[model samples]
Target chain A: MHNFEFVKPGTVADAVAALKGDEAQALGGGQTLLPTMKQRLAAPETLVALSGVDEMKGICKDDEGRLCIGGGTTHAAVAADGSYPALSAMASHIGDPAVRNRGTIGGSLANNDPAACYPSAVLASGATVTTNTREIAADDYFQGMFSTALEEGEIITEVKFPIPEKANYQKFVQPASRFALVGVFVAKFADGVRVAITGASEEGVFRWTEAEEALSANFSPAALDSLSVSGEGMISDLHGTGAYRAHLIKVMTGRAVSAAA
Target chain B: MELSDSRTIDAPREMVWQALLDKDVLKNAVPGCQEMSGSPEEGFEAVVVQKVGPVKATFKGAVTLEDMNEPESLTISGSGKGGAAGFAKGGAKVRLEDDNGQTVLHYDVEAKVGGKLAQLGSRIIDGFAKKMADQFFTNFQEALEGPAEQEPDAEVADGAETGEKKKGWFRRMVSS
Candidate 1:
C-alpha cells in the first residue's frame, strides 16, 4: 500500500474539509477500502477517517415514523435494532461478524456494490440519502454500479427510510463472499407495493416495476407468476449467469413477498 | 465469460465507422485514458487511471484493432497491467448495422483478469468487463452523435509523462 497520512475527524464539516486535500479518500468502516488498499488498487495521498465523527453513528426514529440511520452506524448496530425487522435482518446477514461490526450502511450505500444488501432495502423502502450538502432520493441517488449522485467530497450523513407496512428481503448468498448473489426486497406501502432488486443487475439496485404493479393490485407470491425479468443486462459471473440471476429475481421476490405476508 | 449487448447511435453508419478508427474519439471515450497515442493501424499505447468500485489503479496498456472489414465489423483488443494490483486483457467484437441513416451497434465482449484482481473474487470481473465493454461502445456512440462540448468524466488527473518504463510484459502478449 502507498504511504499516506490519516486523519479522523469529529464532525461532518471537519471530515469534508479533510477530504479536500490532494487525492484524499474517505474511510468508512474500512470493510472494503482497507482490503482494496492492501491490493494497491486504490492509493490515496490522504485518508480521511469518518468513524470518529460521533454525530454520524446511531439509529433513531423520526416523528414522521421514518427510520433515520447515521452514516457511521455499523451493520451490527442496525442488526441489533428491532425497529425495522426486514432491514435489520438484512443487516444481520451481511458478511461475517467482523464485517457486520465494521461495515456501515452509509459506506455500503456509498460504495453501492451491485451485490450489496442495503441498496435493495433502501431502494425498496424509498429512503432518502442525506449528504453533507444535499438530500437525494433513493431513486436518484443510485446511478449505476458503484455510482451515486453524491458529488466529489460528498459524505452521506444520514439515510431516512420510511417504514413500510410490510417488508422482507430475501437474499441468495454467494457461498464464499457471503455477499448476495441475488437479493430481492419487497415492500408493501399503504398506497402500493414497491419492489427493489439488487445483486442481479449491472445497473445496480433497480425497481422491478412490473412486479410492483402486480403486487399493488394483489399482494402475493402468485402475483409475480405472470411477470418475468429478462437477464439481458444482469450481472453474470462464475457464481451465476444473467439468466440464472433473472430467474432468481422472481424466485427471491416471490419468497420475499411470502415472507412479508 | 461472454457477454453480448448492443447500442443504437444517431449518426450514420459511415460516421460511426470513421469515428471508431479515430484515435481522439477512442481516447476521449476510453474511461480513464490519461494518455493515448498511436494510430489504429500501428496499434496505440495508453496510460489510464481507473477506479472500479474501490479498486483504483493506474493502468499502462496497449490497444490494437484487429480483423478489419472496413465499416461492417471489427475487433478491438486491449491488455493492461496495474503493477502489483494485477493485469487484464479483453476483446470486443463489434458489428454495425445501418438502419436507414442511423447506426445500430452490436458487440460481444469477453475479459479476464489475473493476479490480485482475480484473487479478489470472480463476482466482480465479469460485471466489470460487461460494463467496460458497454461503456466503451456507449462512449463511442456518443462521440459520434454529439456533445463534444463537455469533457469526458473518466479522464481525471494529469500526471507526468510516463516514458518507456515497461515494455517486456506487453511484448510477450503482443507476440504470443
Candidate 2:
C-alpha cells in the first residue's frame, strides 16, 4: 500500500529494462499483484506494467503451426478464440467474468498456483514457455507449487501450445472461490496421450502417467476404469481430504477423456 | 486446524536441540520472519509477514516454550495480530527422538485464525500453514546439516534463490 512507481512499457525490451530496479516487479492485469500489495504483503518499490506492450498481447498460429498466445493476452481473449475449442471453453470459466477480463495468462502461468487452470493445459498440451531470455519446455518450466524455472527478472513473452488431436479440461470447482478443487486436462496426440491433474497435489500440477498409458492404448473413458490414482502426494484441507481429491482426480480425468473422445 | 508432521535430521538429538535454541537459525528457518528477540526460557517475540494469494499481513507475536523435557519434547504456543487482516493463535507440541545416530523431530500443531483471513476459507489457510511448516523444517534440516555443504560459489547468488523458493509456496497457496 505504500507509495510506488508504475511504468507502462511500450515494448518487451522496455518492460524488461524497467524490471531491472532493486524491488521492481512485473504487473500483468493486477488481478493477483494488486490485492497482495493492498494487504501490504508485497511492497515492491516499482511495478513494470506489461499491458502496454503490443508484442505480448495476441493469439496466433506460429510458422511452425503451434498455437502461440502472448503472455499479456487476457483470459477473455483466449475464451473467445475459436481455434482451440477446449482451451477457449476452459478460459471462459476462469474466476467468473471480471477475473477472466483482467487476469492475463502470463500472470497465471508465472504465478503457477497449484489450483490454477492454466498449468494443467500448459503441461498437458506440451507447451513451451517463451521468456525474454530463452524458451523453457513445459516439463522444465513448472518446478513445483507456485514455482517455475524462470530466472530472476525474466519476463514471459509467449506460450506455445501444440494443437493436440483431441483435448479437454474438466474442473471440479470449489463453489466459493471457483478454483479447481480438482481439475483434469486430457490431451491426445498422434504420438501418445498426456494427462495432467491440478488442484489436488501437494507438490502442484502433475501428469497422471498411468492414466495416460491406459488411455494411449484405448482412448476412452472406460480405459481409466482399471487405473487408480494414489493419495500419496494429494493435498488435504477443509474443502476435501487427500483421499477425496485422489478419487476426484480419477473422476475428473475420466470425464475429461470422455469429453475429448 | 491441526497438523502433524515428522522429519528426521542427520544429526544427534543434542545437536538438533541446540540448533532449535539458536536465534540465528530460528530466524532464518522461519518463513518471512523480519525480526526476532528474546530467549528460549523467557520466551521470544517476532515479526512475521505472510501472504496467501492477494492477502498479505505482517504479524507481531510472542511465543513461549513450556514443559521441561530437555532435548526430548516441549510445547510452543503463541499469538499474533495482523491489524485488519486478522489474528492467529497457535501452539505446537514438539518431540525429539533418537533414531540411531540421527534425530527425529515430530510436531503436532493446532492453530486458529480470526478476521479477514478466517473468511478467506479454511482450505487456503490450511495450505499456507502446511507450506510454512514444510519450509521451516527444510530450513531447520539444512541448518542442522551444517553450512559447510552449501556450494561456496553459489552462496553469493543464494539470496534470490531463497526468496524465490519461499515466494513460490506463498503464491501457490493463494493463487489457487
Candidate 3:
C-alpha cells in the first residue's frame, strides 16, 4: 500500500472532520479495508480511524427500549454481550476468532457483504441504522450488495435493534471463509414475523416475505412446509448453485424458526 | 467464473453497436478504467484499477474483437497482469438483437483469476465478477437511454458516481 496519513480521533465530530477530504476513508477494524489497502485496491490518501472514538463503542438500551450497539463495538464484544442472546450468538460465528476480535458490526453492516451475518439480524429485528447525520430504517439502509443508503462522508454511529418476541439466526457457513453460504434469521414480533436471508440473493440480503406471512399465522417449522424459495435472483458460485442456495434458504429458514420457537 | 446477462436498451441496434465500439463509451462504462487506447480493428490497450473484498490492483491489458458480424454479434478477448495481486484473462461474446426500435444486448463472459485473489476464495471473486458485469450493462443501458426524464442533473450525478464497483480482476493477478 502506498503511504498515507492516519488520524485517530477521539470524538465523532473530530472523526467526521478528519474524513472531510475527498481522498479520506474511514477505517473500521481493518478486517476488510486493510487487506484491500494492502492489495492496493483501495488507496485512500487519508485514513480516518474510527476505532479511537469512545462514544462509538458499547451496547445499551435506549429510550425506545431497543438494543443500541455502538458502531465501533467489535464482534467479539457483541458475541459476549448478554443483552441480546440471539444476536450475540450470531456475532460469535462471524468469520473466526481473529476476525471476530477485530471486525465491528458497523463495518460488516457498512460493507454489506452478501454473505455477512449482521445484515440478516438487523433486517429481521427491524433495526435502525443511526449515522452521524441521521437515522435510517433498516429497510431503507441496505440498497444492495456493497451498497447502502449512506450519503457521501456520512458515518454510521450506532444500530438500534428492537427487541423481538423470539429470534434466532442460523447460518450455513461456507467452510473456507466462515461467511454464510446461506444464512437465515427469523424474528417473531408481537405484531408479525420477519424472515431475512443472506448469502443467497444476487441483490444481497432480502426478506422472505412469503415465509414471514406463513409463520405469522402459525409460528412453527411446519408452517413453512408449503413455502418455497424461488431461485430467480439467487446467487450462484463455486460454493453452491442458485438452486441449492434457494433450497438452503428454505431449509435454514425452517431451522431458524424452529429454533426460535 | 462465468457470467451471462442481457439488457434491453431503448435505442436502435445500430446505435447500440456504435456505442459499444466507441472508446469513450467503453471507458465510461467500464468500472475503474483509467485509460483506453487503440481501435476495434487493431485491438485496444487499457489500464484499470479493480477491488474485490479487501484486495485491489491495477491491471494493464489488451482486448481484441473477434468473430465480428457487424451490428449483430462479436467476441472480445483480453488478458491483464497485476503484479502480485494476480492476473485475469477472459472473453465475452456480445450479441445485439433488435426488437422493433429497441436493442437487446446479451453477453456471455468467461473469466479466470490466479494468484492471491484466487487464494481469497471463489465466492468473492465470483460475486465481484457478476457485479462488474451488471454495472457494465447498467452503464451501457444508461448511456444509450440518455438521462432520466425528471432528474435533469441526473446525468452529471451519474457520471461522478462512476467506478464505485471495483473492476480490474485481471490486474489483481500479480505478486506484490
CAPRI tier of model 2: acceptable
1 against 3, candidate with superior TM-score: 1
Which pairs clash in the backbone of model 1?
A41-B56
Of 1 and 3, the candidate ranking higher by lDDT? 1
Return whichever of 1 and 2 wins on DockQ. Answer: 1
Encode model 1's per-residue lDDT on B1-176: one tens digit a residue: 68787888776787777777878767866777778999999999988776878888888999999999989999988889989878888888989999988888888888888888888856767767777776677556556554334544332233231112122222222235
Instruction: Please list the residue runs of candidate 3 whose C-alpha ends up more than 4 Å from where it truly belongs after superposition.
Output: A1-3, A38-41, B147-176
lDDT of 3 by residue, A1-261 (tens): 877999999999999999999778888898988877776667888998999999999999999889999999999999999678889999999888889899998888888988899999999999999999999999998877777777666888999999898999999988777789999999999999999999999778999999999999999999999988787768877788989999999999989987884
Stretches of model 2 off by over 4 angstroms after superposition: A1-3, A35-43, A231-239, B53-55, B147-176
Q: Give the interface RMSD of candidate 1.
A: 1.4
Model 1: CA > 4 A from native? B4-15, B69-73, B95-106, B148-176
TM-score per candidate: 0.88, 0.86, 0.87
- Considering the two chains of model 3, state its CAPRI-style docking category: acceptable
Q: Each model's C-alpha lDDT?
A: 0.85, 0.82, 0.82
Query: Worst ten-residue run, lDDT, model 1 chain B?
Result: B161-170
TM-score of chain A of each: 0.99, 0.98, 0.98
Give the alpha carbon lDDT tens digit for every residue of B1-176 in model 2. 67899988877887777767767667767777777899988888989777554455789998777885889998877778988678987877889999998999999988788886786545656666666776777677766553335333221144775654442232232234
